[model samples]
Structures are given as C-alpha cells and as structure tokens.
Target: MTSKNRDLRHLHEFDAERLITLGRAVIETETAAIAALAPRIDAEFARACRFLLNCQGRTVVLGMGKSGHIGGKIAATLASTGTPAFFVHPGEASHGDLGMITPDDVVLALSNSGETDEIVALLPVIKRLGVPLIAMTGKPRSTLAQAADVSLDISVDKEACPLGLAPTSSTTATLAMGDAVAIALLEAREFSAEDFALSHPGGTLGRRLLLHVSNIMHTGDEMPVVTETTTLREALLEMTRKGLGTTAVVDADNRVAGVFTDGDLRRTLDAGIDVRSAPIAEVMTRQCKTTRAEALAVEALSLMEDHKINALLVVDDQQKLIGVLNMHDLLRSGVV
Candidate 1:
C-alpha cells in the first residue's frame, strides 16, 4: 500500500475511493447551501437591509464560539464598507457587555443550534431595549428564532463533518448570508468608493482613492526654484538646498520656463560645459511634464509612469508654479 493510503486507513479506516467520495460530499453540501440562499434573498433580506440602513446607531453583531469569530469578521466588513458596526461577545453580553448595545442599534445574532445558552441569555436584554434583532440560525423554530424580529434560516441539510458535530457547512452559510446583508445595505446607502477609502486610510486602497497631489507635493520654500536667467551654478545651489534633485527654471513672472534636474546636470557635466556661468534655461528641459495641484496623486503616478521620470512640477491654470512632487513623495504617501 502507498504511504498516503496507509495513513488514511489508520485514522479513517477507509479506502482511497471512500475518502474521495467524502471530500466530494463536503464540497457539494456547501455549494448547495450557497445556491439555496440565492432564492431566499427576496423579502426578508430586503427587510433586514432596510432595518440596518435606517439604524440610528451602530450595528451590534453577537454570537457564541465559532459563530462569534465569524461575527467579528462580518462586523469589520460592515464598518469598512459604509455602515458603522462592532461585535460583542454573547457570553460577555449577559454579564455587562450588553451596555455596549443601545436602543437605536440593530442586533445581528448568530447561533447554529438556535439555543446556544450564551446567545439565549442576551435575548431578554435585546427585547427590553427593543433593539431590532436579526437571528441567523440553522433551526428557525428554536428559541432564538421565535424571539428575533427577523429570522434568517441558514439551515443546511447536513454538516460536512461525518460525525455531524463540527460547525462547518452551517457557519459558511451564515457568513455568506451576513455578507449578503451588508452588501445589500451598502448598495441602498449609495456609499461611494471615497467614503470606503476614508475608513481604510491605512491601506493601499486608501492611498489610491483618498490621496490627492496637493497632499504630497512640496510647496513654499521647500521647492527648488531659480530664475530662467540664473546660472547653472545658482540652479545647482537651489537643488542642493531643497535636496529634491531638481530645480525649476522660472521666467520673470515666476511661471515655469523649463526644468533642470540631476539628470540634466549629469549630462551637462559629461559635456564639460561651463557650469559656473551657463544660464540654466539653456540646458534645462523646456518640455518637462507637469501636473495640476488638484489632480489625484494616482494621476501624478500615471504621468510619471508614462513619461519614465521621477519628479514633476505642480502648476496652476495660468502656468504659475505651486509645488514640486517626486517619487519619494509618492512612496511616503503610499501612492506608489
């Protein structure tokens, strides 16, 4: 016998064919559970969405054990998407955590057996406070279902676990249903991507969605600048002072005439020109790429990418210089 077959036989006492059949059954049960949930999204789901959308306070998600863990995740999803929500442990709710829930909040309770002692212990408090309760349970006829304002039937024909003790298929169905509720409310609220980005300011999505060029561009005296008539030596002094590796060459009006960067300086040095007295405008890039102050930082990134450069000047509509932006700015802003 193969080593794999021997190992399987030791614990399961089953042939390879039987193990394969069991795995297939587990997958099928969960698949069927999801498909069944699709048709049930008509009225009750709409009611739940409306309740959550109009909730005057945060949505309080509560569950016990494995369901509690799933509740925590669902709470996070709801909070970041648009709705304000948080998870409270059912066991804690009976002691003092019930204070975290308020009259204006909506309660989403999860229980597989629908009679989990910890979950049942909080029902009276939820009722006394008159917080609308949505119960997600396998047994709709159980105590929790009867007490709930809306009962979401997450019943699976059977668990994938052969012993029928583990909470696998049922939990998946419940979590899927929870996600459905959150997304439905999100759509009804007309929540924008920018609103979601504000909630996730620490992530890459926030960088892309919330960031604008004005936030990262260097302004005031920090920007390297020299008059167009200024010598290459004067321009180099400004670049060194700002340490931005580039200097703007401006006309008499302070409008950008050209740009001289470290790259241009290097080529000028290679040509062995008179760096001391040469006018910067003679050597500066006359057609340097620029960005507007109000542009998205993402747009600045695209401009840099398409032009294969590292820095850009921020300008106003009348062609006046406002700020300078570089790849390091993009890096610091999490826009890179």
Candidate 2:
C-alpha cells in the first residue's frame, strides 16, 4: 500500500468513536425514513396486497441499477415467504424477457424517480398485455407512476450519503416496504414454519424444523446402554465402547430406568465407591428427560439447553429405549 493510504488506514483505526458516530447517524436517518412510511401505508398498500393475492400467475419485479439489486432481493424474499415472484431486469424485458409476463401476472416495477426509461418504455406493452401494474417510486406523478394501475409511494426524506447520491435510506426503505408486503401476504395465506422449511431445505431453518430425533439419533447397537443390574465399571465400559460419554440404565423390561454419565462416575470416585462392584442403578440419575423419535431435532436441542444436559434417550410410546443422542450428535447434524 502507498504511504498515504497506510496513514489514512491507521487514522481510521484510531478514530473509532468518529466511525461509530457516523454509522449511528446513518442508521438513525434511515430508521426515521422507514418510520415515515407507516402513515402512508393506507388504501394503496392494501390494494397492492390485493393485487398480489389475486394474481393467478407470478409477481414480476422490474427495476434499473440499485433498484434492480433491491428488486432481486425483494423477489427472493417474497418467493421464499410463499408469494410466487421473480425479478426481471427492465432492460432485459425489452430485449425479449417481456414474454415472461402473462396477463394473469402482477407487475411490480421499482424506480426511485418513477421515470426509468426502460421501464417507462415498456409501459404500453405491459398495459396492452392486460397485466396489473403496481409502481413503487419516490415520485408519484412520474411517467411510470402515471401509467401504473396502482402506485405505492416509496419516497424518503434524504439520502444517508452527504452527497445525496448513493441509494442508502431509499434502498433501506424499499427493502423494508418489500418485507412488510411479504409478511402481510404470508399472514394472509397462513403460511406455516413447515412451509418455510420446504422452501429452504438446505438452510439452518430446514434442519431445525424438518429434521427429527430419528433422523440424527444413534440407534440399535450404537446405543450406550446397560441394565440396572450392571456394575458402574460395566456401564463405564459401555460408554467408552459407544464414545458418547453416557449410558442409559434400563430395567429388565428394556425400559429406560435412569442415565449414568461421566459426571456420575466423578461423584462415584469422590465417594471412594467400589465402581467394579457397585450397581449402576444406585448412582444413575432416575429423573432423565427423554424425547420421542418423531420430535423435531430443534425441540431436542431446546430440551438439552433448558436442562443444561448434553445427551438424551429416545424412547417409544411404551417408554422403552429406542435410540440415543448427544450434543455432539446434534452439532454434527447442524441442529445445535
């Protein structure tokens, strides 16, 4: 790096307070702009929602420059939240992607000035196609807004940039408005967590909601288990064999009677008990929290967290041990 650039970097690092103050100012400004949108969310906002809800096809979002970037994100959020939507660049639309729009589709066009040339140019074709148009713009009287069937104002007081050129507050407001519309539609459709999980099968949300205890639990021979009649030494051996740091103590009926962990072994050692001969039942924790195989893995994580325990026994309806799971298992499964 040049000497001047290095000096500037050092100055920036040393002036932490100034950096924080500037950051706070930008956040506060954007926050106020978003707050201003609430009162304006009147009949127009409701109409936009109705247009989307009544749409038989998809919600096609169009924009130019920074608005296009925000439009893409809005489309993705809407799609994931149960509203069928996709982003189509205005420039691309004129080049032939306009065929993506159907008469049943609802077109949501975004332009801060409401006079984006590409979007404005396609107004006649969109109208001719008989598709419903919803315009989100800073200027309600601009050409695109004038051509729209319904216009929702996305105006902001000022840009966070001192030059008033960068799209800071405007983009934040637009994104927030997109979220508001998506959530409203989501609630209207009574979308569930499972529905969201289906849309995000590879994400953390899917793992938490769709994965069950049975999907990640160690079963059959992998279970570290011993009978009530077994010695502490024998239970310790089982724990070592399974490498789970704990063992379930079952009764003659094969029902989980208690759990013996390394912690219990520590206490046994502190008491100077004869582990080789002492029955595990005497030292095992009888009030163990167990889960069903069908229970969500996130629920199992919550149980472990609430009880400050690291492992649990999976049981059937008859309270017979079916499987075993530990914090390590949960971590490996991305459920922790």
Candidate 3:
C-alpha cells in the first residue's frame, strides 16, 4: 500500500467505542451551548425582534467565513417563517452589494469576535444610512456590538472542537438564537399555516394546504355517474368507462342518491343478485361519504381514510352531483 493509504488505515484503527464517545461529547457540548442561550433571550432579543418586525424593507444579514454559513440559514428561517430577510456576503457587500441596503432595511450582522474586518468596515456606512443595526456576537463589548442598536450575546464557554480553533459550539448557539428571534417575530405577525404555505408553494405542506377538491376532482363527462334507476350492469359499465372503480348514483334532478362501487358489486354477486336486472339503487350505498368542491384535498383524503373508502362524491349544498374524486386522483395529484 502507498504511504497515504497506510496512514489513512492507521488513523481509522480506533475502536468503535472511542468514536462513539467522541461523537457524544461533541453533541453534549453543542447542546449545552444552545441551552446557555435561553437566559440571554432577554430585553435585547425582544428589541431585535422589534427592529425586524417594524422594518419597512427586508432584513439584510451580513457575515464572514463560518458565520456566513450560519447567517444564510438564519436568513432562510426568517424569510420562511414570516420575516422578510436575505443574506448578503460581507466581502461582496463592500464591492457593490452595499447599495442593496437602504434606510428602510434593518442590518443583522453575525461574527464570533464581532470584529470581522469586512463587517466592521461597513459599520460607518450602515450607521450613516440611519437604519437599525442588530449584532449577534460572542463579545458584548466588541466594536460591532457597541455600534449596534441591539446586541445579542451568543457567547459559548468553549467550542466542541478539540483543537478549539474550528467553530462548533458558537455557531450552534448563534443558530438557536436566530431561530428564537424568527419565531418571536412570526408569532407577533400572527403568521398562519396558510400564509407559510403561500411562501412555500412548491413544498409538500403547500400541496396539502392549498390544493382543493375542485382542482383535482374529475368533472362532467369524466365523472362516473348513473341514475339510481339504472341497472347494475349499466353502472358497472360507467365505472369501467371512467376507470374510477366507483360510480355516483343520482336521481332525476341530478342529486346524489347513493354510490355504487366495486366492493358493492362483489356483495351483490355474493348475494346471488343478477347484475343485468338488479336496479343500481338496491345495491348502492345509501349513506356514503362525500365532500364539497371547495374542501381541501387533504381533508378529502382524511375523510376517505376514516371511512375506509377509496372514492368520494363531490356535491353542492343541494346534494347535486358536481364532481367525483378517487384515491388514484389524489395519488396522482401528489396530495396523498
């Protein structure tokens, strides 16, 4: 083996117990650091939230190195939760991106030392713009904290990194503090699930919340429907034609009278009833589950699941058949 390969194999020679203990130590250290931030969520945290909640424009986040990565995540959490925010790289901001910040925007800067050169240099410009500045740093008396309208102490006793050089505990503490601020602002704004869904329309939660029965239900000719007086064979034919495995049995006024499904047909066959002559009304389920067109598709899914049924008829307030949906429709629509 090559020298590098020999070194790699030797490096991994530690027993499983040793590796596990190291992993657990890191987690415990980081957890304690996050716990330490709870007491620090004082008036300063409230003041920071106020600045963000009252800002006319977006919250511009600035950070450098490892802090930049944490800032990006904080910005995303704020934006998704209700507060409008985005991350701006400190180095980039110096060249030309600084113009992106306006007087209406609030500046949130993150630095472990609160003395990151790129961020400290922008302090004068941010102050001159007359916008509120919020600083999250380990040092309370650092330049960034002193110049800010609100200073959040995210200090950690020590990092989980054995070398004490890599950012571990401090970054975790900062991230937790950011989440605390974001959720506080979210509650203050009374942000609802529907509002969050609107912001994340492409996500699964959005599909479950925003999708309605009308959007995916089969309508008109696509719906498998037959009159109550129709023969069982005719109803089966309608189900086959539409491929929904179920057919709505309606009355003369097109009102839903009952429903006939493949399961009902099995019961009819077992009862020795002739499909060609038996009226659909006699075999259809009189008390079937249904939903409205305006109902959420997830609600329809829940109703179907509760009733142990695979299909549902959509009717208006007058009980007239307007549409029909089945499990396959929901599965295809990504609402299942």
Which candidate ranks first by TM-score, i.e. highest? 3
- Residues 169-207 of candidate 1: C-alpha lDDT, one tens digit per residue: 888998999899888888888888888889988889888
For residues 146-166, what per-residue lDDT tens digits would candidate 2 score against the true structure? Answer: 999899888999999979999
The full ranking of all candidates by lDDT, starting with the best, is 3, 2, 1
Give the number of the best model, judged by lDDT.
3
Candidate 2 off by > 4 Å: 1-24
- Distance from true position, residue 227, model 2, in Å? 1.9
Model-by-model lDDT, in order? 0.90, 0.94, 0.95
Q: After superposition, how far is residue 149 of candidate 3 from its true place, in Å?
A: 0.8
Clashes of each: 0, 0, 0
Worst 10 residues of 2 by lDDT: 9-18
What tens digits encode model 3's per-residue C-alpha lDDT throughout 96-213? 9999998899999999999999999999999999999999999999999999999999999999999999999999999999999998998999999999999989988999999999
